[model samples]
Target: MRIYKVGGAVRDRLLGIPVTDIDWVVVGATTEEMLAKGFRPVGADFPVFLHPKSGEEYALARTERKSGRGYGGFTFHASPEVTLEEDLIRRDLTINAMAEDDQQNLIDPYHGQRDLEARLLRHVSPAFAEDPLRVLRVARFAARYAALGFTVAPETLELMRQLSESGELEALTPERSWKEISRALMEDQPQVFIEVLRACGALKVLMPEVDALFGVPQPPAHHPEIDTGAHTLSVLEQAALHKQPLTVRWACLLHDLGKGLTPEEEWPRHIAHEFKGLKLIKAVNERFKAPRDCQELAMLVGEYHTHGHRALELKPSTLLELLQSFDVYRRPQRFEEFIAACEMDARGREGLEERSYPQADYLRGASTAARTVAVQPLLEKGFKGPELGEAIKRERLKALKAYKEQV
Candidate 1:
């Protein structure tokens, strides 16, 4: 049996980009033959195996017939008749459809090489429509390859539009959809994903809430450049510029999503836009199948919009109070999550507001407290168990009362 390196690794290798995953396709290997040859068999429903020594994946030369919808609903055949070409034909984009044999000779049954050279992404075959998840994949690829000057083939875009309008994308589990979106969010120019989805008419299919951000007008005094959509894109660009983690970046993108739902009555009434923003974050996460921690990050951005800087400024007594306000002791990691997201949130909106958010001023005052007791470790202070508990409670309450009096 002949083994061929396939998909993204080949594409990345050709592009002189660093590749992380190595996928291989084999011709003339049956499932039993693979197992007999010391490959640790996995994927019973489909035909995939792990190479014993190399630990790299070596999938059987298999073919698929579309049966249902989304990504999972398919019937695969790994018989002697299946050719390597048949496997690549079902791939979403031509760049990902190329393969390389053991001799390191690249295979290009489809003109994936031509498309990659041309900076284009087209489906391998008409079978692309069998799985709607390809639309999101293509959208992500558009963002990643945008610097390559790649464009989606017009036919592929048309097919995506048809699938979206027909709601074939709706069959996708929220988890699966977010898996693609989360990866897309990590891209350098992720706004392209949103734009591509909008072009394909799939944004409304998955994210109707934030999709409304488009064309939503902003007042002339603060934002004369463009609508909320434009502003969000700018914010996303800025967030990307910071080289922050995906969670922080996502909060920046969604922090202003609530503005679209607010009435533009001259001054822009987003008094509790933070509150609305938090709910939308949860909704978006649920709709897109985000993890609990991710959902919490989004919620914390909205819920703790006011108190980030306040934590830094308080007297040790007052600092305890502010920490208590967030109920931090029981949820340390989550509270820290809120702090990180709030920093991103403020940074995203700071320029547009062009004025100090409440937290900014509070943070300025907080530096003094940091100078004093910042190094005092509570664990080393001879406090343990419920005694540790009572001391903390006493200090926190005193801080809260003192902080309120100062305000």
Candidate 2:
């Protein structure tokens, strides 16, 4: 019996990219042999198993049936009728279809190596249109590998477009859609995926609110070309260029979502945008079933985007009081999130960029900088704790006063 390494783990290794996971294929081992070897029977419905000693997964090569609709519509056949070559035939792309034998022998049954050399993502078979989920998956691969600068094979792209228009993917439950959407959001080049989604027509069905953002207008001074949708994607691109975490990036993607639903008025009449934004935030979070902490961070960002003159006028003590008043510390993770959101809010506008809103100074130097301010010394210096806190309060007043004098 010969076993081999397979899939992205092998492909990534060959390309010298850091592999994120490892997969294996045993060409001749039966499930009973695997079980006899103490592997756990984990694929009662699917033929996958987990080795007791290694914990890595192993699955018998299999083929699929378009038995149902959407993601769940597929049925599998792995017992005898299908071979490893047949299983590989149903895979979405050649780059993902090749396998590696334990002896490091290269398996090129589908010429996947040639496609990899050519930087192409070609479907294994014309059957790509049978599953709607492949549309998003291919788009996601584009995003993930956008840096690699490969192009999707023309036939594969056509298949994606056809499947999307056929509404086959619409049968996917919110959970399944969320799976791809969440991964797409987490990708290093999310905008690439989004643009590809738009190109393929999947965006319209997957997220109309976002799809509607295309060509939506923004203030002329801030954004010279395109509308609010373009601005949001730009912000998302900026977030991607940094090390900001997933939830923060998600906020950046959705921060200006309200603009799509808001009617036109004067410059920045989108004053009520934050309130409307809060409601929309809930819908997005609930629709995607995002985590609880993410929901709070989203709403807080939506609420304070209009932070007003107090932001410019408040004393540091008052600022601390204000921060404490909102119980911001109740969720420290949420506070870190708010800073990221603020970066998005302040950076999301083209007008702000045009004016050179002192990008770094605004987000890092001014808004989110941490101040320790000798707390123990203030308490030790003849003032009671309350008095000391009040003194710290006064210290903020002094700072704000100095700021006003400078201004």
Candidate 3:
């Protein structure tokens, strides 16, 4: 059997990027032969094995045919007869279809290297439309490589449009869709992922809440971007620019969902949009099965981000209530993430990206001041049970008031 390093490991190496994972494709190898050689079988639907020594994945070269619908609706054929070219042809993108042999020979059957140099993400074949997951995969690649000036090829985009209109994207499982969404959000240009999905019409089908924001108007006084959708994407861009974590980025993306729900007559104003957004955030969270931390933070930011923005004007009682809602004393990191999301929102507007967000530091300082009021001191003063709770609340409010006045 001839083993060749393939897929991302080959592509990333060619791009002078640090290759994180390596995959091997074996030509002329059968599953029985792989097992006989002490390789551990791991793939349930195909002939994939872990190396006997390195524990790296090495799958026997296989070809697939579209069987039904969605990503998992494919049947695979793997045997000694399967060619390396056949396996490479089934990849989602041209850049990923290249391979490297043991002798350091580059296999360019589909001109992947040519497309890579052209900074285009071209599909390997028309068969790309057969698997709906490739739509998200291509968008994610666009997000990852956008900083490098890479864009989806026009023809490839048309195919993506076809997939989006085919109603096949609905066949994808929530878990699988979330995997792509979360990874794309963490990429260097997370907003590009959303933009690309929108360009191909997949966003409307997969994330209607987000899609609805595109043409909605916002008050230009606060958001120079004007369009709610543009503002949401800008917030996501700010989150990525600051190298914020996934929870913060996800929160920023959904924080403005309520604005999309605002009535057309309301125009640039979205009264209580934060409250309106909470339900949409909950819907997205439930649909994608987002991580508990991500779901909780998104909900918090959606419901109370306005309170965070109005930190300077809120009464000490209101500040304390906000902190209590966040349970800042117990889950301090979530509070920090909430503040980060709010800051991203504040700075996401056009010509306002570099503007200072004093609200962030103000809220952080408020939390600190409230936290400094020692519960132990009250306990020593004989405050007990509910009385102790009341006394501590009173003390925290007093501290917050003092801190606010000093600022």
- lDDT (Cα, tens digit) per residue for candidate 3, span 1-407: 99999999999999999999999999998888989999999959988999999999999999999999999999999989989999999999989999999987999899999998999999999999999999999999999999899999999999999999999999999999999999999999999999999999999999999999999998888888899999999999999999999999999999989988888998989999999888899999999999999999999999999998898999999999999999989888899999999999999999989999899899999999998889888889999999999999999999998999899
**Local distance difference test values of all predictions, in order:** 0.74, 0.70, 0.94
TM-score of decoy 3:
0.98
Tens digit per residue, CA lDDT, model 2, 1-407: 45667888878987789998888766566778778888787755677888798899888777788887787788887664456787778888888888887778788688888888888878888878898888888888888888888778888888888888887876877777778877887888887888888887888877777787786676676455447777777777766766577777777776666766766554333556766676777787887787766566666666664452236655555556545534543444565566665665556555554233333343223223323234577676788858877886565455444544554
Residue-wise C-alpha lDDT for candidate 1, range 1-407, written one tens digit per residue: 87889999999999999999998888887888988989998867878899999999988887888788777889888876778888888788889999987787888988999999888889888888889899999999998988889889899999899889877898998888888998998888888888889899999888876688887776555566447776666666655665657776676667666776687673344566666666677788778767766666666665654557445454566555545554554565555545555554444442553434565444333332322332236667888888877765665455455544665
Model 1 CA lDDT for position 40: 91
Which candidate should be chosen as best, given lDDT against the real structure? 3
| Candidate No. with top TM-score | 3
- Which regions of candidate 2 fall more than 4 Å away from where they truly are? 264-271, 306-310, 313-326, 348-407
Better of 2 and 3 by TM-score: 3
Which model, 2 or 3, shows the larger lDDT?
Answer: 3
What is the full ranking by TM-score, best candidate first? 3, 1, 2
Candidate 1's error at 302, in angstroms?
2.2
**Clashes per prediction?**
4, 4, 0
**lDDT of residue 186 for candidate 3:** 98
